[model samples]
Target: MMDGSMFIDEWHPSDHYMSEDLTRPARHRTRTQSPPRYYYIDFGISRKYDASNTNPLELPIYGGDKEVPEFKEDYSKPWNPFPTDVWYLGRAIQETFLDRYTGVEFLSGLVSDMMHSDPAQRPNMDEVFSQFQVLRQGFSSCKLRSRVAHDEKRSVFHFLLHWARRIQYIVRRIPPTHTSLA
Candidate 1:
């Protein structure tokens, strides 16, 4: 299904941002060191009319031309708008590329960093690429995750990850080993 990125048929001059790629797909394409495209702006009245709802999923729209609080001002309960309520960038990208690729771990953290409450703290495209490189390298073997035992073993990759996580959880809950020994 087409999302707000493609759903948008119109673009205000002010709403437009510099495109680093021509096909537009490349504009948000995943670089070797950077992350994939992740647009989280809300489109406005047009999307509302299309969806029959006031909350538009396009971030560029809602937060761009239309201010969040001002948009909600006329309503009884005024509140700032969140892109998640209308759409999820992380899930959207995951679905878009589900059949195309594997190892989507970077997306989760990328989305978190991009959707930080403070835009100032958000990573720029270059920084995103740098961090993405590290994350991608860190989980490079995720796709190769598997195990075998006597030619009859379920994938211990997932199982081991789950178990390891539980161990870490327990370790965190327990006091430091050195401290206990001391």
Candidate 2:
């Protein structure tokens, strides 16, 4: 069972706790065995409507209809990208793989490619399938640990590179020294 919290956690979109229970109250040895009960209750009207109108906290259901102008798009683009986070696949991977993805590096790369901000960078489904096949072959071998080692080294390299860039930014932010006038 997966859910999209969107914004609220303890409560749903309507700004109220779901008084309605998600499951039948059952007897069990411990609370840990029970499945989490997440229900949609909060009507985050603001999410649907603009902030300026949410203050009243109610939408006029009857005659308040109006046309919202759609944003113009470039016809040449192959895909119309979503304006929201594409995090559902990551969650699905965690659930499906159970954190034991054989080709962890390859899967990470797939996720990264999917999450690339530029639509042009995203791989097509066929390319993704081909890459997965290659990764599966690498993970099946036990004799050579090079594949896993490569991932570790790459992670370290990226970490160091990020750190170095951050340090450079901080140094650049430092005030310049004033020369002595003597």
Candidate 3:
């Protein structure tokens, strides 16, 4: 099942006890330890549907991210929560990552589609995931591992240092992104 309240803050790593092995410091963890898992919270405004039900609709319940375009204009009207969920996730990524870092411009297209003004025009979560997988597969390891430099200005020394670290990571054969680990 998908979350109805899909704001970024609603997702969190499970409590320490629930994921003790994965939560432990790297030095303390064993090679066989499972990857960390995240859980969704604050389901007070969430909804559930049967597998047969495809086009479920609901009146808006404002979430932590209140910038949903449809809701901003007229939230009283019932609409598909699925597309709004897509907007929540897309806006979250745009604000949390795209706006704050570099080297992830590949996501701009997908994010733009997810945040389309017309909710009906937005791709559903499944499509989003599928599109993201395609994007992820297209990136070379080095490109994926390239330092996601902050959007802020930095000194030449810092820029050189970043390249140096990139070379070091390549030499050490470190994996670019952690999603593959999961």
Count of backbone clashes, every candidate in sequence: 12, 6, 0
Residue-level lDDT tens digits of model 3 in 1-182: 23323222223345322333454322322111223444556788888988787788788878787788988786578887889889988987899789998877889999999999999899988899999888888888867756676767466877897787667766777555656532
47-99: candidate 2 lDDT, tens digit per residue: 45454542232322221212111112333433332211132343345445535
Model 1 has an lDDT value of 0.40
Worst 10 residues of 1 by lDDT: 26-35
Better of 1 and 3 by TM-score: 3
Query: Where does model 2 exceed 4 Å of error?
Result: 1-91, 94-106, 143-182
Q: Give per-residue lDDT, candidate 1, residue 54.
A: 38
- How does residue 81 of candidate 1 score in lDDT? 37
lDDT of each: 0.40, 0.39, 0.72
Against the true structure, whose TM-score is highest? 3
Q: Between the candidate structures 1 and 3, which one is better when assessed by lDDT?
A: 3
Query: Which residue runs does candidate 3 get wrong by more than 4 Å?
Result: 1-40, 179-182
lDDT of 1 by residue, 1-182 (tens): 21324322333333333233322422221121122234445444433334345343333334333322234344443332334332233335444543244444446667566545443455655566677566645642323231212222336675686456445545666321212111
Q: What does the lDDT come to for candidate 2?
A: 0.39
Check candidate 2 and list the clashing pairs: 12-42, 13-42, 13-43, 13-44, 14-42, 14-43
